[model samples]
Target: MTDGDLDATDPRTLPGFFDALADGKLLGGVCTDCGQVLLPPRPACYACGSRAVDVEPQSREGTVFSYTEVHTPPPAFAADAPYTVAVVELADGGRLLGRVAADYSDVAIGDSVELTVHEPTAAEREVALDYETDWPVHIFEPR
Candidate 1:
């Protein structure tokens, strides 16, 4: 998708992004100006402040850039305290933050991982806003 098609109804939007994710496709925005990749396909590039972002498929493969264990989670995630989370640098150049499917003890910086998507659990849906209730949740799995 090109910049001209980036509206509230396209993959650059949350609903459209989740829709594609639910179908197991990962899409990101490639900056025409500086080649920065934006997860969830935003209309503008955060790196160059350009409006030349183009939506494209992205690789699910990545490596952990940074990680930490979440011992103190928000109320919505209280049941899942002490979970592992990380900022993964994707093979396609986009970096995204997500829950890691592995334990904190099992993951390290530079660990290979793959992104996965799943429907929100009942508990997750309980805390989601009306528009986000059906959005797919993404997690990174150690590979």
Candidate 2:
């Protein structure tokens, strides 16, 4: 399907997100009712319960709102046992949870970051995103 056909309501919607990711594009679901934007497109508007939504393009830069270093990873991520994850505030005011593309010791809550997309190895995907993803995963590196 085409990017124009990406639907937040489809059962394959999450996979469609990967499709966009593979294309070096980031997508967010914008609620028509409450004007809220969410990453990893949800089925309905969290604010106003609107099923009417639009698939929107997202900015590539953001600031970290919160972050944590993971030292003890699960088996899937044992290969890269230590990493940093961050809650980033996207330019559109949407927050995304993603790997911080930096050493764990360097990440901070207020750091400015820009997007980097990676088509990771199976192990790296699991380590970074907690998913053995088939498409590129998003990372935020210090700007």
Candidate 3:
């Protein structure tokens, strides 16, 4: 199956994340009880085991917690190899994992960044989060 051909409605599918993306927003789950934040959010909190989770709009602004340059990506991401992957700590105390953008040579731990979504190309026009153009890819740019 192609990247865009995968089923996106199922929570088990990454495309389900795109459902939020299509609306030009990014979503993360927050525990209703303890207020712990989750990225690539879950229906239940890993911390307090609460099923009363609520969707939260993540802050686009964050600081780089850590990063690494991957010379080799998985088969699916091979085309975007030699990329920087980062763990960013959002201002609201959440974290997100994603690519750091092409011009990221000067990045360092604790650098400030803001999120921006990128639309998929026509060739990748599937109804998944990876294919949503209307939804911006939550990429980090220097702040």
TM-score of each: 0.94, 0.83, 0.74
Name the candidate that leads on lDDT.
Answer: 1
Of candidates 3 and 2, the better by lDDT: 2
Deviation (Å) of 22 in candidate 1: 0.7
For model 3 the local lDDT of residue 112 reads 89
Residue-level error in angstroms, candidate 1, position 66: 0.5
Q: C-alpha displacement of 97 in model 1, angstroms?
A: 0.2
True-structure RMSD, every candidate: 2.1, 4.5, 6.9
- Which structure is stronger by TM-score: 1 or 2? 1
| Residue-by-residue lDDT tens digits, candidate 1, 1-143 | 34465555698898888899999999999998999999878788889899888889999999999999999999989999989999999999999999999999999999999999999999999999999999999999899
User: Using TM-score as the measure, which candidate wins?
Assistant: 1
Tens digits of per-residue lDDT for model 3, 29-59? 7788999987766666899887776766777
lDDT by residue for model 2 over 56-97, one digit each (tens)? 988988999999888898887777658889999999978998
- Please estimate how well model 1 matches the true structure, expressed as its whole-model Cα lDDT: 0.92
Model 1 clashing residue pairs (backbone) = none
- Candidate 1 vs candidate 3: which has greater lDDT? 1
Position 16, candidate 1: lDDT: 88
Model 3 off-target regions past 4 Å? 1-16, 102-104, 122-137
lDDT of 2 at 31: 87
